[model samples]
Target chain A: MNVIVEAGANYVGVIGAGEGATGEQMVQARRVGELLARKGVRVVTGGLGGVMRAACEGAVGAGGVTLGLLPGSDRADGNQFLTVSVPTGLGEMRNALVVRSSEAIIAVGGSWGTLSEIALAVRTGVPVIALGGWPLPGVEVLVAQSPEEAVEAAVRTLAR
Target chain B: MNVIVEAGANYVGVIGAGEGATGEQMVQARRVGELLARKGVRVVTGGLGGVMRAACEGAVGAGGVTLGLLPGSDRADGNQFLTVSVPTGLGEMRNALVVRSSEAIIAVGGSWGTLSEIALAVRTGVPVIALGGWPLPGVEVLVAQSPEEAVEAAVRTLAR
Candidate 1:
């Protein structure tokens, strides 16, 4: 229960397919992370492979803070780009941690795990912008056409 | 990372709506908890009101172990029926903890939070039995007609 409140630090989650992600999706996720990091927003992710690794790489490359909520207990399982990696050991349940830790979420692609994070964020009243994500029938999500649009929407949603 | 491996202890999560749970759902959830407890299985819940409280109450009444993963950092926020309440401080994210901690899941009813847990469990290869829950189109969940059926399914799933 150690609550560390960093003043003026905005954590935005970038959720997407972990394995089997398309190259296009990875490119979009990387750009999204870079944009958010350049804006001084901390990028948070599930802390594994595919989109999560790509986003963290982009953020770290831009000299920005990146937090990874890793699924396993081993910190070595996290990508090299993560500035701070929390080995939650909660398996895929760490997706919920990623959603809870972020002020807003930018969904880069679609997957069952990513869908669960989006569902948790929506249920908990966290604003989410999806870029090339699933077409949730009843879910209320703002669909962004590109990575830049997704980052802009996330920033604007947090401002509100 | 303190991992307490309780040998021979089977933990089953009973998830449902907290605030707007119907009386029927409460009765079913309570029966599910009681049945699981009678079999020497531990009942895990979200540690709040409605179905979570009802299930914990039943399990405690049966002199069984009941664990609650509370959403906030205050242990006092948990219901009195919980034998061990861990204040996760992860908001709705605690649903994932409940899912990860359980060997099987018996969903008494459905909500956005419950759905998130169900999705996480299914994604992580955990068995799920839905009793009076949602009919997810593409989701492969075993449906039970009553609490007894749900508890039986949970036990059988764990045995496998």
Candidate 2:
């Protein structure tokens, strides 16, 4: 068990819709954040509204650190739950960084932006566990039934 | 015509693929850059390769100022044609800024990244001229057969 314990910093990105998240999506995303936080995993996100904020809040609630990669130039654009705010004024182009930076990803229902992240992640060989997220062709992403399952898959993927 | 060319900074975004652009794509993008430069329009781009580099080179060839919004943190990642390179470190999300900052957009052949920019620009009501680029759904973007026509459309849109 001691041998399996990783030594370096591990970042888990929780990706989903920035705005207009459904009630169920927000709940599941927040729960995923909480579960990952409880296991001492650092949660990463785009840090705006909807699912990003929910995940960050969940991480914060569980005493876990959250990193917010904001699209705007202003740091204030980040959510209140972020422990660190990287205001990357790159707008939507920052999605590549978000997908690339994460060791593993937990994706809930998302938009075209989220679809793009999934594509980028798959292309770069980043493991993604989708919880009702966009379905892409020619990409092999694991589908989770619930938040608990998503977090479980994430942990298993990263532990290896 | 001289009166119409008022003294102001006209920022035009030249967006397209990083690589895999056809020779025709490069030629048209270059001509667009040249035309914009002749009309005193400041060209903006992602500043790496393909259509962006070609556009910037044309702008420089015609003595026009070009700005590159780089995705990486390294200033050296940007191409040489840019008069000013803004290292955004935001990766692909910089597309939004590239679109929003420009008064009008000229899109050459592109992949997923360029497709995202076109979608974003249309969402924000920024005029776009697609010079043999992808055809997006529900977006009213102008399709031009040549670089001259693309530049003409952009100039007309911005002037209005």
Candidate 3:
């Protein structure tokens, strides 16, 4: 019998909405997660609702492993799609942790909290791929018109 | 002339999608920004696309200052709503920077990327608020069913 060694999966950070799901943002976030799953990449996000949930659902649906980085201390805070939920006691400061844990960041539609996460991501030198918003200051701007293009750009960037 | 001290706003880090707006995710993200703006909080995020853009828009719309953290070296990566743009060439590593810069984290939903962020957040002991995802270990769990509730939880947690 030959023993095979399994390598650790590459992690990607996702940030976005957590309200009632219903609109273009939700669709795009889900599609992006699916595309990333199709590419055989593990997905990471702030397990909540809206875009985060959509992405988790998409990734899990695609037979991919989805990790949920929680904000609270309980597992109930996480969505059902998450394979593993890591609880971070950090409250508002968790933004830094999110940025630090990922090799790259794929930003979707977001708000104030999301903006702060993006800032930290840029400061840490993570490659951020944007789909329909403004580009980062000194990083490569992978602006995609569609979810497919956004994920494609992220994959291509990761490949490099 | 009486000099009134203007309270320095908390440097909030934002994270989210980057596609065109209109969805549950987008709405949630926007609400986060709105809440922050109403409180005169400084918002930060990846200055592009879906959630980031929406958050920035919401913050600016509410008379709040928004910052964009770009992943590339170009200003084009930043969203128009950002009052300031910080350019970072770190690529995906920028995610780490974002997490490091913040005092806490507010997770909207769950995604692979978000999960990674949450991991970093928890690992760093940054207080995190989960609106629709998993909670971090040993941290306060604030499962906000609405945007107002989430923001309140985040603010209250950070205050401690």
Candidate 4:
């Protein structure tokens, strides 16, 4: 079967923890999504819970499109915030999808899962801006203190 | 797109590094694949190069079914060793698929990527057998010295 892949330059990855996200971190992720959406960016996320849910909520709340790349085979499993859900059945490997499909990555508080996406983004030369995410040595991950800064950096990176 | 998802018990995850696998490690992976296949277990992997390729080769060589859950959107990106390639388009997140789909996990020498799968498997109550793989602090990962031992232990774990 042919699965229609999401293709475009307007997509941006908001990488973060799939679970156990702090309430503050979720708020920041949501704001980041809102800011990105205001710029006409289509937010891409892991499509599970915590930060993913919050980000998608904020983006959709701001009347912007969002895509959820679910790890399971059922689209119904995606968060209520997503405008489109693609049940990839790819599991955590979908982290690579979030990185590869986005023009740039705006990272929030994350763990092992978010770190994987950051690594993949760096490997593929996709610009990554960490708002409050794990920092790796020897990799150039731009740091932003707030959601607005993160979106601005992503926009500037894409412009270049 | 009615994408066919590979589900159920015959599936087994062979976890390892995406690259930088030692020649000996690859051999062990291949042998483990062969043994599992002979026992009618369908081998599952990330579907990239190195150990993944070797394992798929050994499984298919023994006339056993093998599935490659690829990180990209193109099936052509999979190694030639697999019997079927499902382009998961999920990147490293695909590790979750391997953990959730398999009845048991046979972990070879791996890096951070395989470590994630191990964590997932342990949490999901899927049995795991480690062959020179990283050990977790609190998880019960059975150790094996050889590919044969690893496969045997994995099968036993599933049986129980």
DockQ metric for all predictions:
0.42, 0.17, 0.04, 0.12
Itemize residue pairs with steric clashes in candidate 4.
Answer: A91-B93, A92-B93, A92-B94, A93-B90, A93-B91, A93-B92, A93-B93, A93-B94, A94-B90
Please report, in order, the local distance difference test score of every candidate based on alpha carbons.
0.87, 0.83, 0.69, 0.81
TM-scores, chain A, per candidate: 0.93, 0.92, 0.87, 0.91
List runs of model 4 lying over 4 Å from the truth: A1-9, A17-19, A38-40, A46-49, A57-65, A68-100, A111-149, B1-9, B17-19, B34-40, B46-49, B57-101, B111-153
The residue-level lDDT of candidate 3 at B128 comes to: 64
Give me the displacement of residue B83 in model 1, in angstroms.
4.1
True contacts kept of each: 0.65, 0.13, 0.02, 0.13
lDDT accuracy of residue A14 in candidate 3: 72
Which CAPRI tier for candidate 3?
A: incorrect
**DockQ, Cα level, model 1:** 0.42
**Which has the greatest lDDT?**
1
TM-score of 1: 0.81
Which of the predicted structures, 1 or 3, would earn the higher TM-score when compared with the native?
Answer: 1
| Candidate 2, A16-125: lDDT as tens digits | 98878999999998999999989889899998989999999999999888889898999988989998999988777677678777999999895666765765676467
Ranking by TM-score: 1, 2, 4, 3
Total colliding residue pairs, candidate 4: 9
Give the per-residue lDDT digits (tens) of candidate 4, residues A44-139. Answer: 998888999999999988888899989899988899999898898866656667776788998898565676576567756789898886545444
Q: Least lDDT summed over 10 consecutive residues: which range in candidate 1 chain A?
A: A1-10
Worst 10 residues of 4 chain B by lDDT: B1-10
Predicted complex 4: CAPRI docking category = incorrect
